[model samples]
Target: MALLGIIRRWHLRDQIPIREIARRLDISRNTVRRYLRSETTEPSYAERRSVSGLDKYSVQLSGWLKAETTKPRKQRRNLKQIHEDLKELGYAGSYDRVAAFARQWKAGQTEWVNSASKRTH
Candidate 1:
């Protein structure tokens, strides 16, 4: 959006040539022209459907997080520790994924945090 704004400003306000705009912006002339012609803020992207390395571990992680709520803050395991535990349990995801999961879990909403409300098989 910001890039598109600059492109629009340079083209509509300053009346700069497209090639010059592309040169100054260090982007392709085609890209600058595409944005200049486009009416939308940005081109839409499809949602990613790939399975996460963490997907397999989600249930286990959710259980651990649920159990942690009973512990005092000082006694509760941190994101890194939870991530490390996931690692031991064959979780192939990155620490960021685990940390994100931990944050949502701690919030008591979204993702695995809502698992308690879900009907189990």
Candidate 2:
């Protein structure tokens, strides 16, 4: 790679063809061009450090969400009730956050079950 740097310098100072530098360096012509043209940079990806409150209670919440689906239709678990239940089960978090998590969890499960039911019929 350092040999490429020397070849690159020679090309710059002598106005030699880029193909000459690439062939002597034993690298692709496009790679030589990109190295000559590009600035050093870092790439990044967006990721959360942690899931909000759910990280602590995801397993319990998932179990409750599944239970809600398996219950009789008339006795479906509501967000407020789930929040209360979570509180009773040692969740030391805000009710609103728990309720929000329940809503999203229930929505996803409901969609899955509804799709499966349609497929069976």
Candidate 3:
């Protein structure tokens, strides 16, 4: 958005040529022209859709995490141990992927608990 503003200001206010703007900004002249021609203040980009290798094993991992919450703190499996367990099940992704999923899952659980507590109060 800032780049778009700079491109507009340079061309409309300062009357800088498209070729010069492209050279100064190290961008394509066509890109500068497109920004200037567009009426919208912000450029729109296609939404990104990314799939993780862990997607296949997410349900199984979630089940294990939920079960662990019921166990005594000392006996519960930590993330490393859970990663090892997933490896035994043929999950090829890195431990970091598992850890990230766990963090997201824990966050969702925390939000649910907080919301439920708020309703009761």
All candidates' TM-scores?
Answer: 0.50, 0.47, 0.67
Give, for candidate 3, the lowest lDDT window spanning 10 residues: 40-49
Clashing pairs in 3: none
Using lDDT, give the best candidate's number.
Answer: 3
lDDT of 2 at 31: 83
Query: Which portions of model 1 miss their true places by more than 4 Å?
Result: 1-46, 107-121
lDDT of 2: 0.76
lDDT of each: 0.86, 0.76, 0.94
Q: What is the C-alpha lDDT profile of model 1 across 1-121, one tens digit per residue?
A: 7899999999999999999999999999999989988878766789887878888898999899878878999999987898988888887779998888777766765555468657573
lDDT of 3 by residue, 1-121 (tens): 8899999899989999999999999999999989999888775789996999899899999999999999999999999999998899998999999999999999999999999999998
Error at 36, model 2, angstroms? 16
**Regarding lDDT, does 2 or 3 come out ahead?**
3
Give the Cα error of residue 20 in candidate 2, in Å. Answer: 39
